[model samples]
Target chain A: MNPVKVIINKELKVIFNSLLFYIAFTVFFCTTGFIYWLSQGNIFYTGQASLGYLFTVFNGVLFFLIPALTMKSISTEKRDGTFQLLFSKPIKTWQLLAGKFFAILIQVLLCLALTLPYYITIACLGHVDHAVGFCGYLGLIFTTGCYISIGIFVSSLTSNPLIAFFSTFAITIWFQFLFEMLSSWLGNTFIASVFMYLSVNDHFDTISRGIIDSKDIVYFISIISLFLALARYVICKSRI
Target chain B: MNVIVKDLTKIFDYQKAVDSLSFEAKKGEILGLLGPYGAGKSTTLKMLAGLLRPNQGSIHFDNYTYEKNESKIKKLIGYLPEKNPLYDAISVTDFLFYMAKLYDIPRYKVTSRVLDMISLCGLENEKHKLIKELSKGYRQRLGIAQALIHDPEVVLLDEPTTGLDPNQTFGIREIIKTLGQEKTVILGSHILSEIENTCDQVMIMSKGQIMAQGTTAELRQAPNSDFSLKIVIKGGEIPAIQEALNQLPQIKSLQLQHKQEFEVHCTPGQEIERAIFELCKDNDWYITEMTPVQMRLEDIFRKVTQKQ
Candidate 1:
């Protein structure tokens, strides 16, 4: 097997064996399930038989969940000195980062898959726009990928998991809301447009609305790649 | 493979950790790096293992250099760091299998290789145990097992037996000696006896520079060229024995050790033993005991390292 696959398998096994995985999985499922059904402005209140509200709520839930899942990816390895063990193999720095990236992505995807019951209920109630629903899931996957990449990059910067967690949360919060907020405050300027474009919320919004623009896809991919590249660079520089 | 390191240097925060160190180890040779703490032994081994990049100079394993063939070079090296970091949550078998896979060992052979390492490191009983539950000696054995699981041509071990008991240290040294028969093995430690027992070529390092380098016998012979002998005689007056020993030119210095025993420092390359036997025979003094005291590596290590 290749080094990336070996790393991913080890990572997944470790994640599954830990109590943290069960806790994160339970909390994410319960919170998203409760908000979609029992909370105010729930499906029954709108009575629209659409997943639009659920997707919006999911965006917020995932903003926090992704960071929690990815906070220990690289930081724990650094702190425990297992980075030496991994790098001693024939694996390149990017392959290691990519392995961790996909492993966390797989975990988040598993959590998202559990919400299929909500989708089933909505589809049973009335006609659902399948295109928007598909796009919404795609948008969630893209957004989760971007968040994990950013989290891994932050995790590489420090050996403390708490610091990795908080810094990732801080940075994702800026991308999720602060950028859009700043863009709105500085209305109609060139820098404002740049901030608007950088905001993850705007691109996710565009993709979830059933408008599969190349620009949105490019934006998400670029952010993921950029952060992963930065993570690789950080690991390489730290070794020296 | 022959491993050659030339003018290798590593600077940390403007302080040299390994200062232009150079050496070579041929295949089937064990090179021991002996140094005190902070003498850069670990740093040198790390650079050789490709865990750290050197600030200058180069390393070549056979025809391969790290610059153009880092992955290739890595594939040929098995390194156990000083701290021996491992995944505490994983079982020993799983960890070994994972390392085998990482090194791209053939899938069909990984199980057999893992089994080989488990038995070789004497970790048979602990193979199913979580690493966190094992004692430090077992953990160290597991560390070495993982490093050797891939069967790399070059093995770099940093203080492989730092905290083990005498038995465990002996086991590890035996394993190292076995590896030295077929691989280019570089063992780093500050323990003089361990190095003296296992290394074919010994390098004593101080302040990031090599203070002495040669075979154990050669190094032992280099400094303190004089050899000593302990002799015990009976049925002769102490003054007469002392006078007879003092008359011999080979006896440089003599100290009365006990009632009838004397410690004699002899000049090198002389027939001092025969001369003492002949003198005792002629004087009617029976030689009760005679034993030569060889110079030890410890004395040389102390003398060279403390020179700074």
Candidate 2:
């Protein structure tokens, strides 16, 4: 079997067997249901039951849950001394890193797949543009990928899962919010542009709104690549 | 296939762990790297295993050099670190299978090979259980199983039997002996008795350098030196015994150990047994036993390490 498949299978098995995954899944479903119900009641701003809006809210929930799921991908291995076990094998460093990255990505994809009923309900209730909904799901997955990369990088930093989660959460929030704050004070167009572009929120927002801009796609891919590369470098240096 | 290490040195920070240590392990021979704590045994093993790049030195297996061909070197050797790091979540069978995969073993043969290894290491009962649930001994067996899963030619086991009980230690020693029959094994440990019991040739190391390297017999029996003999006799007169032994020009020094025992350290150019028999023939000293005191590993180690 391919080594990545070996890692993916192991990660997926752990993610499925874990109680935290079930808890996250249950809470995610409950909040999505509540949000869908609230939108149905026509709250402020003439709330419409759009799949795109549900996806937007779901993305916000994922900002917490996805990190919770991925924080242990590498951290647990190091804590349990399994990372060293893998290194002693004849496998190369890149194969191991890619295996872990894809394994976490598979879990995120599974959790995202469970939310399909929300999209189906939106289609039944109102005129939901299928292409826009599809694009929104794609954008959510891309954002989840970016979050997973950051989570992996954080996991590489420490062997404690709690520390991994909090550090990743803190860094992701900084990337999402600090850039906009910087844009207001800097006033320079180039500086503001750089800050906005660096923010994952900015790119995710554009892609989720059905505009498949090449730059946004490139940005998410680059973020995934850069963080994963950084994770590989950190792990190698740490001699794990 | 002899393995050669020349000027092997590994330093961490300012501490020199292994300094210019050199040795060789001949084919089908177990070279025991004996040393106390912080004596650079593990560092030398790591350098040989290609896990740590040496600050200076080169390791060559027959014709292939470690620095020039790492992949080939790695392919030829298996290393068991002091800490038997195994995946706790995976079963013994799966871990061995994973090792086989890493070594690029054929897929069709992985199952049977894993089974053979499982049985070889006496891991049949715990083969299906996760490694974390197994006892320390079983975990160690699992570690050895993985090390030999690929069947590497040179296996460097660092304290393989560290935490094992007597029974488990014997089992591991048997496994190692079986491996040593066909493969070159370099085992490092501070246990002098284990090395003396298992290894054919021993290398006593200290202070990041090898103090001595030779077989037990070769080390103890220094050439051109007086042979020491400890004799057991049924009670006898001390003056008469001393006079009889002192008559021989070869017997330079003699001392009584106890009521019935005596030790004779002879000068150069003395055949000890001939002189003792001739003395006993002329003067009737009933010799109950005559045995040569063989040097133990402890004595050899102390002598070599304490020397300048």
Candidate 3:
């Protein structure tokens, strides 16, 4: 494998070797299953089942899980002094960030995969919109990518993993809830529309409702790329 | 593999870590950086490895400037930082392979090259173990193994034996001695004896500047006005012994401060001992031991830095 793939593999191995990834996976699965069961009422949603509920549930769950997964991306490297060793080599800064970012992607994917049993249950119970469910998953992935990128950027800012986790969790939660709180203050003005539109929760909610708007997809991709770029810049400057 | 550092300087807030420092290392030769703590040794090494940009100077590797050919320079160089930077959870084998991959070594070749490095550093049995579980000596070996995995042309080791036990120190010293046979090596340490034993040349750094740079023979030959001689005297009046030794013909000047001791300065290479022996024969002030105290590297470092 090339350096990027090699680094990705190394990081994946490290993530799997630790018990944190498993813990995050178990918690996400248990919570999503419980919520799905509760939302079913006594008959477990005999009507058409939509993926929107799953998206909402996972969004809340990722608010905690993403920070847990990405808190050590750069912080652990710095604390262990391994950052200097990596910098001394011939590889560029962007490759390392991409490698680590993809590693976090694999973990998020695994957590999503653990919900397979829930998907099977949904398919067995009643009619479901398979296309909308797939699109909803694509949207969840897009938003989670943005969250992990933001988390990685926050991780690069400090060597303390707890601080990285808290900062990332706080920023993600703030971005998700800021506009809702802003609307109450602005009294539903036109400016509140822009704030609400800019919020990640708003964009994710729009896409999870079986609507594939280009603008929502673009917003998620751009936010992820921007944070990943910032993370690259931060690590480069700090390494030098 | 030649390195030229010109007027390099780095200032941190109120202190200059490297202050107009300049030096050069020739191809296939070991250059020892000797200095006490806070003497800019680590800072200088960091700049050389391109991990830090100098504040006010240029570094050139061969004919290429450091900035213009950073990737090329990094490919040709291997650096072992003062603090051993190994991932605790990574096995020795995996770490070496990771570094080799970074250097663009072929996938099929990385394994054999890694094995060669492990063997060269005598880390064969511990190659499968996690780095954090290894003893300090073994961890140091792994550090060297990683640095040499790609077989870079220039290897810079900072305090490679700083915390190792005596046997470990000897092992590191031996590896360095062998590495010097094929690759140009630069090591930074405050231990003067290690430099004297392993390096072909020494550069003494102090307060962000190089005080002296030369081979041991060349440094010993630097002009000095005074030479020390430790002479043991047999039973005799201390005053008489000093008086007899002062009358030697080759002595330019003499001082009789102690009863049995006297400090004498003479022309370089002049033999004043014969005259002293002749003068002392009558009084039976036998000379027990005669040794010349020439200027050493430590003396030069202390004298130059103290003057600064």
User: Best candidate per lDDT, number?
Assistant: 1
Kindly report which residue stretches of model 3 are placed more than 4 angstroms away from their true locations once superposed: A38-48, B242-275, B278-284
Instruction: Evaluate model 3: give its lDDT.
Output: 0.83
The sequence of per-residue lDDT tens digits that candidate 3 reaches over residues A1-240 is: 566887898898666767867777888888877777775542355354656776778778877889998999999888888887888888777888889989888888888888877777877877778877887788788889989999999999999999999999888986678766786578868998777766888888877777889999889888889998998888877644
Better of 1 and 3 by lDDT: 1
**Chain B TM-score, all predictions listed:** 0.88, 0.87, 0.89
Give candidate 2's error at residue B279 in angstroms. Answer: 9.1
lDDT of 3 at B68: 88
1 against 2, candidate with superior lDDT:
1
Worst 10-residue stretch by lDDT in candidate 2 chain A? A38-47
Top candidate on DockQ is 1
Candidate 1 lDDT, B174-193, residue by residue in tens: 99999999999999999999
lDDT per residue (tens digit) for residues A143-187 in model 2:
888888899889998999999999999988876678878986788
Candidate 1 stretches with Cα past 4 Å from truth are B223-226, B232-290
User: iRMS value of model 3?
Assistant: 1.6
